[model samples]
Target: MYYIVMNMNCEDCGRYIPHSVYKYIGFCEEQGKVVFNEPPTNCDTVSKTTMDSLSSVFGSLGWVYCIDCKAPIFEMEEAVKHIASHHLITTRFMYDSVAAEEVGAVS
Candidate 1:
Protein backbone atom coordinates (compact mmCIF):
# COMPACT_ATOMS: atom_id res chain seq x y z
CA MET A 1 0.00 0.00 0.00
CA TYR A 2 1.15 3.59 -0.76
CA TYR A 3 0.53 6.77 1.12
CA ILE A 4 -0.84 10.09 -0.15
CA VAL A 5 0.67 12.11 2.62
CA MET A 6 -0.44 15.69 3.23
CA ASN A 7 1.58 17.22 6.02
CA MET A 8 4.79 19.15 6.57
CA ASN A 9 6.72 16.57 8.49
CA CYS A 10 7.04 13.14 6.95
CA GLU A 11 6.70 11.54 10.36
CA ASP A 12 3.73 13.78 10.97
CA CYS A 13 2.26 13.41 7.48
CA GLY A 14 -1.47 12.82 7.60
CA ARG A 15 -4.23 11.75 5.25
CA TYR A 16 -5.10 8.35 3.88
CA ILE A 17 -4.46 7.35 0.27
CA PRO A 18 -7.69 6.96 -1.64
CA HIS A 19 -8.47 3.67 -3.32
CA SER A 20 -10.13 5.09 -6.44
CA VAL A 21 -8.07 7.51 -8.53
CA TYR A 22 -9.20 9.02 -11.83
CA LYS A 23 -6.83 11.96 -12.18
CA TYR A 24 -3.18 12.60 -11.47
CA ILE A 25 -2.13 13.47 -7.95
CA GLY A 26 1.09 15.22 -6.99
CA PHE A 27 3.01 14.45 -3.84
CA CYS A 28 6.42 15.61 -2.69
CA GLU A 29 8.66 15.08 0.32
CA GLU A 30 11.17 17.85 -0.33
CA GLN A 31 10.63 21.06 1.63
CA GLY A 32 10.69 23.56 -1.26
CA LYS A 33 13.03 22.26 -3.96
CA VAL A 34 11.61 22.41 -7.46
CA VAL A 35 12.81 18.98 -8.59
CA PHE A 36 11.78 17.44 -5.29
CA ASN A 37 8.54 19.41 -5.20
CA GLU A 38 7.03 17.51 -8.09
CA PRO A 39 7.60 13.79 -8.22
CA PRO A 40 8.35 12.32 -11.65
CA THR A 41 5.65 10.46 -13.56
CA ASN A 42 6.15 7.17 -15.39
CA CYS A 43 7.53 9.02 -18.41
CA ASP A 44 10.31 10.69 -16.49
CA THR A 45 11.65 7.33 -15.43
CA VAL A 46 11.64 5.94 -18.98
CA SER A 47 13.35 8.85 -20.71
CA LYS A 48 15.85 6.50 -22.36
CA THR A 49 14.62 3.47 -24.25
CA THR A 50 16.68 0.42 -25.06
CA MET A 51 16.21 -2.15 -27.81
CA ASP A 52 14.38 -4.49 -25.42
CA SER A 53 12.68 -1.87 -23.30
CA LEU A 54 9.13 -2.78 -24.18
CA SER A 55 9.87 -6.46 -24.37
CA SER A 56 11.48 -6.57 -20.94
CA VAL A 57 8.70 -4.57 -19.32
CA PHE A 58 5.85 -6.57 -20.84
CA GLY A 59 7.63 -9.83 -20.04
CA SER A 60 8.15 -8.92 -16.40
CA LEU A 61 5.72 -10.63 -14.05
CA GLY A 62 3.69 -8.47 -11.75
CA TRP A 63 0.19 -7.27 -11.04
CA VAL A 64 -0.63 -4.17 -13.06
CA TYR A 65 -2.09 -1.37 -10.94
CA CYS A 66 -5.60 -0.16 -11.68
CA ILE A 67 -6.48 3.45 -12.40
CA ASP A 68 -9.45 3.35 -10.09
CA CYS A 69 -8.75 0.93 -7.28
CA LYS A 70 -5.07 0.49 -8.17
CA ALA A 71 -6.07 -3.05 -7.53
CA PRO A 72 -4.30 -6.23 -8.45
CA ILE A 73 -5.56 -6.69 -12.01
CA PHE A 74 -5.20 -10.28 -13.22
CA GLU A 75 -7.20 -10.08 -16.45
CA MET A 76 -9.13 -6.87 -16.49
CA GLU A 77 -10.74 -8.09 -19.71
CA GLU A 78 -13.30 -5.31 -19.61
CA ALA A 79 -13.13 -1.88 -18.02
CA VAL A 80 -16.61 -2.46 -16.59
CA LYS A 81 -15.33 -5.48 -14.70
CA HIS A 82 -12.98 -3.27 -12.72
CA ILE A 83 -15.93 -1.80 -10.83
CA ALA A 84 -17.26 -5.21 -9.84
CA SER A 85 -13.90 -6.88 -9.37
CA HIS A 86 -10.80 -4.94 -8.33
CA HIS A 87 -8.49 -7.61 -9.69
CA LEU A 88 -8.75 -6.99 -13.43
CA ILE A 89 -6.17 -4.86 -15.28
CA THR A 90 -4.89 -4.20 -18.82
CA THR A 91 -1.12 -4.06 -18.96
CA ARG A 92 -0.85 -2.42 -22.36
CA PHE A 93 -2.94 0.59 -21.42
CA MET A 94 -1.37 0.82 -18.01
CA TYR A 95 0.92 3.68 -19.04
CA ASP A 96 -1.47 5.35 -21.44
CA SER A 97 -1.18 8.72 -19.77
CA VAL A 98 2.54 8.93 -20.50
CA ALA A 99 2.36 7.33 -23.92
CA ALA A 100 2.77 10.58 -25.85
CA GLU A 101 5.85 11.49 -23.88
CA GLU A 102 7.60 8.29 -24.95
CA VAL A 103 9.19 7.46 -28.30
CA GLY A 104 8.20 4.87 -30.93
CA ALA A 105 4.75 4.74 -29.28
CA VAL A 106 6.12 2.27 -26.78
CA SER A 107 5.67 2.68 -23.07
Candidate 2:
Protein backbone atom coordinates (compact mmCIF):
# COMPACT_ATOMS: atom_id res chain seq x y z
CA MET A 1 0.00 0.00 0.00
CA TYR A 2 1.13 3.51 -0.77
CA TYR A 3 0.49 6.54 1.47
CA ILE A 4 0.72 10.27 0.73
CA VAL A 5 2.50 12.68 2.99
CA MET A 6 1.55 16.41 3.09
CA ASN A 7 4.07 18.92 4.38
CA MET A 8 1.74 21.92 4.28
CA ASN A 9 -0.28 23.57 7.04
CA CYS A 10 -4.05 23.56 7.11
CA GLU A 11 -5.49 26.68 5.47
CA ASP A 12 -8.54 27.07 7.73
CA CYS A 13 -6.69 26.22 10.93
CA GLY A 14 -3.03 26.70 11.60
CA ARG A 15 -1.73 23.27 12.68
CA TYR A 16 0.70 20.64 11.55
CA ILE A 17 -0.93 17.76 9.70
CA PRO A 18 0.44 14.31 10.41
CA HIS A 19 1.66 12.13 7.56
CA SER A 20 -1.00 9.50 8.27
CA VAL A 21 -4.03 11.51 7.07
CA TYR A 22 -2.28 13.05 4.08
CA LYS A 23 -4.10 11.89 0.94
CA TYR A 24 -2.45 13.56 -2.06
CA ILE A 25 -0.92 16.92 -2.95
CA GLY A 26 -0.24 18.53 -6.27
CA PHE A 27 1.05 21.71 -7.89
CA CYS A 28 0.22 23.15 -11.30
CA GLU A 29 1.70 26.05 -13.24
CA GLU A 30 0.22 27.42 -16.45
CA GLN A 31 1.67 30.36 -18.30
CA GLY A 32 2.24 32.91 -15.54
CA LYS A 33 -0.28 31.26 -13.18
CA VAL A 34 0.61 28.87 -10.38
CA VAL A 35 -1.81 26.77 -8.41
CA PHE A 36 -1.12 24.53 -5.42
CA ASN A 37 -3.71 22.42 -3.66
CA GLU A 38 -3.51 19.87 -0.87
CA PRO A 39 -6.70 18.01 -0.10
CA PRO A 40 -7.38 17.67 3.60
CA THR A 41 -7.57 14.47 5.69
CA ASN A 42 -11.15 14.74 7.01
CA CYS A 43 -13.96 15.43 4.53
CA ASP A 44 -17.55 14.33 4.03
CA THR A 45 -18.37 11.08 2.22
CA VAL A 46 -21.33 10.27 -0.02
CA SER A 47 -22.83 7.48 -2.12
CA LYS A 48 -21.39 6.54 -5.54
CA THR A 49 -24.31 7.93 -7.45
CA THR A 50 -24.05 11.17 -5.59
CA MET A 51 -20.44 11.50 -6.68
CA ASP A 52 -21.35 11.24 -10.34
CA SER A 53 -24.12 13.75 -9.97
CA LEU A 54 -21.81 16.16 -8.26
CA SER A 55 -18.62 15.41 -10.15
CA SER A 56 -19.03 18.52 -12.27
CA VAL A 57 -19.37 20.59 -9.15
CA PHE A 58 -16.36 19.20 -7.26
CA GLY A 59 -13.99 19.50 -10.23
CA SER A 60 -10.63 18.38 -8.71
CA LEU A 61 -10.64 19.03 -4.94
CA GLY A 62 -11.28 15.89 -2.90
CA TRP A 63 -11.85 16.35 0.85
CA VAL A 64 -11.74 19.17 3.38
CA TYR A 65 -10.62 19.28 7.04
CA CYS A 66 -9.50 21.43 9.91
CA ILE A 67 -5.83 21.17 10.72
CA ASP A 68 -6.07 22.47 14.28
CA CYS A 69 -8.99 20.49 15.70
CA LYS A 70 -8.89 17.66 13.16
CA ALA A 71 -12.55 18.26 12.45
CA PRO A 72 -14.40 16.86 9.44
CA ILE A 73 -15.18 19.35 6.67
CA PHE A 74 -17.79 18.86 3.97
CA GLU A 75 -17.67 19.22 0.19
CA MET A 76 -21.24 18.86 -1.09
CA GLU A 77 -20.02 18.15 -4.62
CA GLU A 78 -18.06 14.92 -4.19
CA ALA A 79 -19.89 12.75 -1.69
CA VAL A 80 -20.74 9.65 -3.75
CA LYS A 81 -18.45 6.61 -3.62
CA HIS A 82 -15.95 8.68 -1.76
CA ILE A 83 -17.97 8.47 1.43
CA ALA A 84 -18.24 4.68 1.29
CA SER A 85 -14.51 4.17 1.45
CA HIS A 86 -13.50 1.91 4.35
CA HIS A 87 -10.80 4.25 5.55
CA LEU A 88 -13.34 7.05 6.13
CA ILE A 89 -16.50 5.25 7.28
CA THR A 90 -14.63 2.90 9.58
CA THR A 91 -12.81 5.76 11.17
CA ARG A 92 -16.09 7.56 11.85
CA PHE A 93 -17.87 4.45 13.14
CA MET A 94 -15.03 3.61 15.51
CA TYR A 95 -14.43 7.11 16.82
CA ASP A 96 -17.58 9.17 16.34
CA SER A 97 -21.19 8.07 16.11
CA VAL A 98 -22.29 11.50 14.92
CA ALA A 99 -21.25 10.55 11.42
CA ALA A 100 -23.91 7.85 11.27
CA GLU A 101 -26.63 10.33 12.09
CA GLU A 102 -26.95 11.20 8.41
CA VAL A 103 -27.19 7.61 7.19
CA GLY A 104 -30.75 6.87 8.35
CA ALA A 105 -33.79 7.43 6.18
CA VAL A 106 -36.05 10.11 7.48
CA SER A 107 -39.84 9.87 7.78
Candidate 3:
Protein backbone atom coordinates (compact mmCIF):
# COMPACT_ATOMS: atom_id res chain seq x y z
CA MET A 1 0.00 0.00 0.00
CA TYR A 2 1.15 3.50 -0.80
CA TYR A 3 0.74 6.12 1.90
CA ILE A 4 0.70 9.87 1.51
CA VAL A 5 2.23 11.34 4.66
CA MET A 6 1.45 14.95 5.42
CA ASN A 7 0.65 17.58 8.07
CA MET A 8 3.55 16.52 10.30
CA ASN A 9 6.89 17.96 11.39
CA CYS A 10 10.15 16.15 11.96
CA GLU A 11 11.34 15.66 15.52
CA ASP A 12 14.98 16.03 14.53
CA CYS A 13 15.04 19.24 12.43
CA GLY A 14 12.43 22.00 12.50
CA ARG A 15 11.75 21.83 8.75
CA TYR A 16 8.32 21.72 7.15
CA ILE A 17 8.11 18.36 5.43
CA PRO A 18 4.67 18.02 3.93
CA HIS A 19 3.06 15.52 1.55
CA SER A 20 5.98 13.19 2.06
CA VAL A 21 4.89 9.68 1.26
CA TYR A 22 5.96 6.04 1.33
CA LYS A 23 5.02 2.83 -0.46
CA TYR A 24 4.80 -0.16 1.82
CA ILE A 25 6.34 -3.00 -0.18
CA GLY A 26 6.09 -5.57 2.57
CA PHE A 27 3.87 -6.36 5.50
CA CYS A 28 4.93 -5.54 9.00
CA GLU A 29 3.94 -6.80 12.40
CA GLU A 30 3.00 -3.24 13.29
CA GLN A 31 1.52 -0.46 11.13
CA GLY A 32 -1.63 -1.92 9.73
CA LYS A 33 -3.67 -0.41 6.90
CA VAL A 34 -2.97 3.10 8.19
CA VAL A 35 0.19 3.94 9.99
CA PHE A 36 0.64 6.46 12.80
CA ASN A 37 0.19 10.22 12.35
CA GLU A 38 3.70 11.09 11.23
CA PRO A 39 5.70 11.72 8.11
CA PRO A 40 7.41 8.71 6.64
CA THR A 41 11.05 8.34 7.60
CA ASN A 42 12.01 8.29 3.92
CA CYS A 43 10.28 11.60 3.28
CA ASP A 44 12.27 14.77 2.82
CA THR A 45 13.05 16.78 5.96
CA VAL A 46 11.67 20.32 5.77
CA SER A 47 9.68 22.89 7.68
CA LYS A 48 5.99 22.41 8.37
CA THR A 49 5.10 25.67 6.61
CA THR A 50 7.15 24.89 3.53
CA MET A 51 5.59 21.48 3.38
CA ASP A 52 2.14 23.04 3.41
CA SER A 53 2.95 25.29 0.47
CA LEU A 54 4.55 22.46 -1.45
CA SER A 55 1.55 20.28 -0.83
CA SER A 56 -0.62 23.03 -2.24
CA VAL A 57 1.47 23.56 -5.36
CA PHE A 58 2.71 20.06 -6.18
CA GLY A 59 -0.49 18.29 -5.13
CA SER A 60 1.47 15.34 -3.77
CA LEU A 61 3.66 13.94 -6.52
CA GLY A 62 7.20 13.63 -5.20
CA TRP A 63 9.48 15.12 -2.58
CA VAL A 64 12.42 17.52 -2.45
CA TYR A 65 14.68 19.41 -0.06
CA CYS A 66 15.53 22.96 0.81
CA ILE A 67 18.46 23.98 -1.37
CA ASP A 68 20.05 26.01 1.38
CA CYS A 69 19.48 23.73 4.35
CA LYS A 70 19.38 20.32 2.64
CA ALA A 71 16.26 19.52 4.61
CA PRO A 72 13.79 17.29 2.86
CA ILE A 73 10.81 19.33 1.75
CA PHE A 74 7.72 17.57 0.49
CA GLU A 75 5.16 18.85 -2.01
CA MET A 76 7.75 20.98 -3.71
CA GLU A 77 7.36 22.04 -7.32
CA GLU A 78 8.03 19.25 -9.75
CA ALA A 79 10.23 21.11 -12.22
CA VAL A 80 13.12 22.83 -10.50
CA LYS A 81 14.32 24.45 -13.70
CA HIS A 82 14.40 27.87 -12.12
CA ILE A 83 16.54 26.65 -9.30
CA ALA A 84 18.85 24.90 -11.70
CA SER A 85 19.15 27.96 -13.87
CA HIS A 86 20.05 30.09 -10.90
CA HIS A 87 22.61 27.55 -9.75
CA LEU A 88 24.23 27.45 -13.18
CA ILE A 89 24.40 31.22 -13.39
CA THR A 90 25.93 31.45 -9.94
CA THR A 91 28.53 28.83 -10.75
CA ARG A 92 29.55 30.57 -13.95
CA PHE A 93 29.86 33.85 -12.14
CA MET A 94 32.05 32.29 -9.52
CA TYR A 95 34.28 30.73 -12.14
CA ASP A 96 34.64 34.06 -13.93
CA SER A 97 35.52 35.81 -10.68
CA VAL A 98 38.18 33.22 -9.91
CA ALA A 99 39.69 33.58 -13.36
CA ALA A 100 39.78 37.35 -13.03
CA GLU A 101 41.49 37.04 -9.66
CA GLU A 102 44.13 34.73 -11.14
CA VAL A 103 44.81 37.15 -13.99
CA GLY A 104 45.14 40.05 -11.56
CA ALA A 105 47.55 38.07 -9.41
CA VAL A 106 49.82 37.48 -12.41
CA SER A 107 49.76 41.16 -13.36
Q: Give the per-residue Cα lDDT of candidate 2 at 101.
A: 73
Cα lDDT of candidate 1 equals 0.31
lDDT of candidates 1 onward, in order: 0.31, 0.29, 0.31
User: Which candidate number has the best TM-score?
Assistant: 1
lDDT of 2 by residue, 1-107 (tens): 21222332222111222221232221121112222233334422211223343343345454433322345435643233333332221111112235457458767
TM-score, model 2 to reference: 0.17
Q: lDDT by residue for model 3 over 1-107, one digit each (tens)? A: 21132443232122321122221121122333232324546555332333345444456545544333334444234224423332100100001224445455553
lDDT of 1 by residue, 1-107 (tens): 22122322211121211122432332222222112212233222212222243234435753344555655544423433542343222332212356456548556
Q: What's every prediction's RMSD, in angstroms?
A: 16.4, 16.1, 15.9
Q: How many steric overlaps does candidate 1 have?
A: 2
TM-score each candidate.
0.24, 0.17, 0.17
Q: Which ranges in model 2 have alpha carbons more than 4 Å from their true place? A: 1-62, 75-107
Model 1, TM vs. native: 0.24
- Model 1 misplaced regions, further than 4 Å: 1-22, 27-55, 76-107
